[model samples]
Target chain A: MTIPIDVETKHRIVVVLLWLAALVALAVLAFIIAVVLWNGLPAVTLSFLLESPRDMGRAGGIFPMVVSTVAVTLLAVIVAAPLGVGTAIYLTEYTSETALTRVIRFGAECLAGVPSIIFGLFGFIFFVIQLGMGWSVLSGGLTLAVMILPTVMRTAEEAIRAVPESFREASFSTGASRWQTVTQVVLPSALPGIVTGVILGVGRGVGETAAVIFTAGSSLHIPTSIFSPARTMAVHFYILAREGISMRHAYGTAAVLVILILAINTAANWLMLRFQAKQG
Target chain B: MTVARREKAIERALLVSALSAVSMLALIAAFILIEGAPVMLRHGISSFLAGTRWAPTKGSFGILPMIVASVVVTLGAMVIAVPLGLSCAVFLAEIAPRRAANFLRPAIQLLAGIPSVVYGFVGILFLVPLIRENLGGPGLSVLAAVVILGVMVLPTLIGIAEDAIEAVPRTYKEGALALGCTHAQAIRRVILPAARGGIIAAVILAMGRAVGETMAVIMVIGNAAIIPCSVLDPARTLTSNIALEMGYAAGDHQKALFATGVVLFAFIMVLNSIATMRIVRGRR
Candidate 1:
């Protein structure tokens, strides 16, 4: 028989391997953030943040793209938040497990799985062509609204379900209607979680490219209205890098995007932690 | 009576809002099929599905090469990602101290929050050049896409897989330890087997992410339409084909691009079905 390693030694070796794996996973994140910031941070400046692009994005700042990003993301959240919360309310408060609920859940799950590019295609045909919205902020925002809907719904559902059942019962014994109980008690307790979900949806909308590029129409011009075709920061970065327009500009844009996303994610995580602490 | 009437109206409104997801799904499928299906029918399904040539201007539209490239790059990514993700997940669930796991969990979700465009930019700056200098192929190849995607899918894989592993009852581990098993051996024999269904589900879900990935894959994959003979060779994927060509395409070319989207949607639906089924089975 082959010489066998002692159990304690073997266990130590495995633990070391697992530690290395976790370290490697974390390292990848650290390295990507470090590399992007290292190269891009110097390029970010006051003018770079405030001025519009010039020379087909070879020079000047990303002010227009910034505005477009905010406009589109805000519109998406405005459209999606109520619908998502309403869906969550319906699922958790108004119904129990049934065929209808199952169908709704299945539809939401399938929607979640559909890829962004397909959403692009659907938006292109339905909103851009059939509905005659064209490639504009309106179409792009609507498309992203649909894209982030499942995420919003799922998060809201979890938050609502986490509210104690006894709270609902107390409202009922006080002769509150189901709708009154949900609106007054359930939603208030779930507000932090719902806001977290909305923030997450905003984060996804901010960074989306493929779907936005098709529906939003990547114009360098600042959007004056929802009908205006304007580029977002993500789409602008994609075009610059892919077309090899200007590496410096691309890096600066990337830095901004990375920092913005990091902030949103941190905010969401903090809110979630606070919510959990309160629940406990 | 008035309160009851008001309550019923509110319930109806909420129910209508709840139907939005289902309606959106139906509309997306119907619209994509309406735009894409005709082109597929015109080309004959087999030619589009199995044809090798894909010159839109020349009236040739075959997507076999892109299909093959998507499958190969996705599978290659899974190969690189699965072991790394599983070990990290295991570390989080079992080996890591509570303080460390708490800090690290959010850190990984941050990884997912990084935009795909940024991932592509990073790949272009570092990974592509690295591959070119060392690996001998054009830096933008299937290999580059695989490496980038492997890292991209890690968050999804680790998050779900860790949940699955942690869901196994503590008694299973205690039983193994009581029977004179080492910690590593007990994990290998009992904990892992108990978590098998969830682990498999995690893999399938990650596979879906890898396949649906667009911006990063487009940047690094060189986007050549031909099938690659090796991972080092350049290739285009189904999503990229749509993204790259949809801008200037007209008429049938546009429809062909939509047809590509149809194919991608179908592939993802299949993956989603399998993952959901696995999750359901695991729960049972």
Candidate 2:
């Protein structure tokens, strides 16, 4: 069974295989991004961005969908940011490592693992139906808030934990209360990380499709209030593509979505890099 | 107000906010169970789990086909992704220069951040047509789901595997290299075995992701509630079934969808816990 293979040849083969694997991964990412941009960019016009849809998304723009997407994302951030930051603060600053902390961490992991469709189901039943929010921006935003809660909390916790212990000790030595130390000293230092988490949450909210579909009714018109039903760009693209309604509009919507997500992700990455630099 | 009282109040408030996360998890589970369990109990758990048919209109709620489809798709995705991901991880951790890794790492993270819907869109536009033209079948088969999910899970698998591989002490490789082993030989003989636990953990986590993926799978899996005879055969997954039907399902049918969710939830939980355990063990 001991065939004498040349070590040089074997090393060369392994290196080639590793290069091929990396190339394949890179190729796939490139192809997908290129295809989306190629097919989508032409459809994205000023009119498409500014005007409302006409004739069930076949003839006009996606202004309403854009508005709805922003509204829902803003609402989700409003609801999730404070709660997530507070939870992170509690975990990092207030609480000792205990069974309760373990349970909470476990819960966050479980939440993170739950599928988007399940969240949609829960949101439809609980927020839209049980709470009488009906398929509206509020219901959709609330559902998204729950879905993104773990991401924000985990990131914020890491950020808060990354704050130097010496900083806290300095504050304590000044006889400042724990609350004051966190709010005035630690939070200011950790703000970049927290903002990065929120931006990432916004990215999720924007790109999310399944979870928002049922809870946020796919209304054609722009939503005027939180109670008003509306469609997000992702849901709009899904409906258009799935129903074979309008590929042009779908591509246009997809292009906008892709751009929005890329922008948010780039900003988040920049903030994270800056935060890391500051830490170093 | 006294500073001590104010500090206590703030601590309590923060504690309550933190506990809300736990409560939310409990609430989701409780509601899903309460809504889903009745139908299962009424229909007999065995019948619900083991039956082949899943016609909600006809009042049959068996999910065997969906379960099989889910497992098949997840396994197929893992089979395709793990090698590529692992090799990529190895290249990044062991072979590539630091400059290459610095450039490649963000690219991989960006891949992860691209929404699932975009993946689904790409699948419908490209993969489905390609499959239909070349491989036959309805194009939107488990093959399409596998391909899309395979790509979707790559960043996850690669990132975790890279971390695990990098976590292997530099001394291990140094020792092997000192013995005159080639870089590849040392990595194959020493580094891989040292990082096996973490790689397995990565695979398990990716499996959880593949099993739970919905929107993309729904777009490409054809949504047929039948056991697939081959990868090219159209079939429905548990997540897809719930999503495709929850819109119009009523009464028993709706309850059946929730029951499906319960199954999916349980599957994810088991995979997640196993992955978590492996990761914890690997860290130690």
Candidate 3:
């Protein structure tokens, strides 16, 4: 099939060029990851992480940040999980694909697409101002809960949809009600996917800065309660960068943030894989 | 006294409340408007949209450069992201061997999980300096914003495009190859055309991500209100503008920040409508 200077070869060349371009982009991404890790890894020690920022500003440990991220993210998932999973149950089990379902679907899309800053703005006016939550962990968690609802809803919906029709038919043959089947059989089957959604939602909450900044009111100390003001690691990084804390805790904070992201992302991947394997 | 009765009540509740998702959405819109309307009303729409200077301290809360910066950053991100992301899609779907793809797929997606603020850090350390030295700038400009956004968006584009390409029928490739076309040629002509809708969806989704991205864009954008005549010039985007100013803002100034959010909200809602429309229409 060899031909002299074939057009097919020329086209293949272009495609290969595209492939190379993509590979190069990946390489660049890898380089960025490598450099950041290189700079960050060397600086992070156990003491760097164990000590709080208040040790005459010498201790670089992110105790407050780590605690705030965990606490706020916990509250966010607890809020979002029930609502999102409930909505998914409603859409998948109870409702028809009627105009209303269509409208809600559209609403979910809109809510998801709404920018973080807009979420922040709304949170500031409603939660921080009108309700006078006063830059507390509660406001940030609620705002992030709203922000992550669509993600959980969509995934949970998909999870429900992917459950086999035969399972329903099988249950019906045994005189089992639709509600019984959904709650007992379907929910269990879709639990992994639901968990995946919750984890990803929590991950987003942990890494979020912009939305929290407006609602949470940027406090540094560990909060005594949900209403207490606080700051997460991401916000701390923002402050460090904005306040010109250059070449100091900034790099370490950045590293901590990256590691947190990577941890969450890894968990998400593992869950997704588990979900697929379960389906298979 | 039956399961059906219980189901009926539950279903009714679900139906009524689900419809309220609309009002909830409208509530978000309403709140943004209600809270932000005072600023636009006070300053008039022209001054809010068209005013050049953004001295919130002096009651000059113009956001024209911020708007310009948002557009410039988004467009620049698209320039770098679209080609690379599409190619990556093409590679995974059309070029790479299946085993290799299976191994690498999750890793590729893992990039998406990297938090925006972390990406901001990477941009500040790596991209800001790179642009400063090579492009000849101080640091933290529209260029840095573009590079960060582009990198951040790559996973989205590739994921969407890969799914689209995978959905292309084997017959399309077979038909092209049957007519003396190579694998690449078949992909070029037939697979790509068939997957255009999905590719377009990917781009739109990426656009949505770009427009909404706040922490990362803010971290690297230098937060300058001046219109960027060059990529090297510092700029401020809509998201960054709000994030930067939402603190310590009160009165009309606070309302204007909310107004900025309303504008961003409107844009994102349009994008959301498109995504939903495509989904519903495509289903039929």
Candidate 4:
């Protein structure tokens, strides 16, 4: 109903001002990106990112952190995928229209609205303290697992729902058990979206701060096992910058985090496209 | 057959197992409160609410100004971000070309992915300097937090508000147009009101983000534990307070941080409930 900013008359000045503000935003976004890219890329050459954080500071690079991030993220996905997919499958395919399903759907939606800090608090108590995981990678990963459950469940549900009822009908006609049809047919159809959710959730945890900081000790020691204290790159950046580290170093770290996020997003998009093409 | 009846029970069991994700939120809440309650009970109500000095080492347990700062900063962010984010949403959904809208959508997503620390870095690097240069005096004030928080919440608000605006029925727009109403008029009159519930929910959610935000606000707010007399003054926020001091806090000081978290939790619970209410009503 509204005119595009360009063509709208009688408000040229307003549009100009809006663009100016947007440009400023863009500029800020760009400068930070550039700083991170400029610093991290050269410093994080293949070996540095590939290497372990067993040596010294500033120069040691973030190998263990990177490994832990990947390891924990994978572990998280592993934990979330079955339960999330099962829940999603039940919601979209198996369950009949009912109050319970409706309530569950609403709960899943609101789960994303909970602040990450609160999740950190939960993780600190449940995984880190009560469970005696004690700031281990296992606790961090499991906490992230629960945090990402709703994401995976919702996306998996949508993807499963997109598999037409005909598929189920045909499988039933072919004498396939409900579980067989669901596991074999519905899962393959929904795999792409489920994978996307996993990717997105990993991206979220990788960038997370308030939640992971408390549960995952910000120790820079290279984790000997999943239970060892470790620092995520995001948390590293927070601690370093908070302690008044030089802007260049902070910018470099931020840049590394951004690049990783961008890379994750790109892969997810590619997966989406490939999946859509297959559907077509 | 007994076998078939057992199979039915098994199906019901599977259903129960799958739907247990719904309980996870309550579980999370309960777990946090359980860990946090001891500290809250020990500190009593007065010092947690009425005091202001936050030295964990000295055993000073005042959090009044930090609580106020959190509220003020969140309010400032909401004041600036809500309108701007709404306008951006309007621009995308109602104003922009399809191509531009599609392009901007992903850019907003990109914005969302950039870490909060990066935003903090940008606040320190760019926003602080810009505010300092133009506005004069000590840089990185509450205004800076507002500016950064406004921009940070832009993508989230825009994405949600766009959905709300887009959810406005096509028939309403057509009817408005048929009545000699301009496209802009239809949007301003019908679409906005129709989408009011969702917009409010989106705004509330963004407010939540602003309140919980630590790294970015901590980066720019200067972390002064004073009652900010104006938006131009530096102030400490609740999340920033925790992140700053939780490092070395021992005993009651650490407990105070937990109490602060309890306060923040109560704040978020209120916001989330409001958001949930609006969202539920809109669905109805």
lDDT of 2 by residue, B165-276 (tens): 9999999999999999999999999999999999998998899889999988999999999899998999999999998888788999999999999999889989988887
Model 4 DockQ vs. reference: 0.43
- Residue A147, candidate 3: alpha-carbon lDDT: 85
Error of 4 at B27 (Å): 2.7
Compare the candidates by DockQ and give the number of the best one.
1
Instruction: Judging by lDDT against the true structure, name the best candidate.
Output: 1
Cα-based lDDT for every prediction: 0.93, 0.91, 0.80, 0.76
Residue ranges of candidate 3 with Cα displaced over 4 Å: A1-5, A55-60, B12-23
Candidate 4 ranges with C-alpha deviation above 4 Å:
A1-31, A51-56, A246-248, A273-280, B1-20
Model 4 over residues A124-229: C-alpha lDDT tens digits? 7789878999987888888888888887887777778778788889998998777778877888887887788778887888887777788877777777788887
Of candidate 3 chain A, the 10-residue stretch with the lowest lDDT total is: A51-60
Which candidate, 1 or 4, would have the higher lDDT against the true structure?
1
In candidate 3 the C-alpha lDDT for residue B81 amounts to 91
Ranking the candidates on lDDT from highest down gives: 1, 2, 3, 4
Give each candidate's interface RMSD in Å. Answer: 1.0, 1.4, 2.3, 3.1
TM-scores of all candidate predictions against the true structure: 0.98, 0.97, 0.94, 0.90
User: Candidate 3 — what's its lDDT?
Assistant: 0.80
Against the true structure, whose TM-score is highest?
1
Which candidate, 2 or 4, would have the higher lDDT against the true structure?
Answer: 2
Ranking by DockQ: 1, 2, 3, 4
Give per-residue CA lDDT, model 1, range A1-280, as digits (tens).
Answer: 9889999999999999999998998999999999889989999999999999999899999999999999999999999999999999999999898999878887888888787888888888888989999999999999999999998999999999999999999999999999989989999999899999999999899989988999999999999999999899999999999999999999999999999999999999999999989888
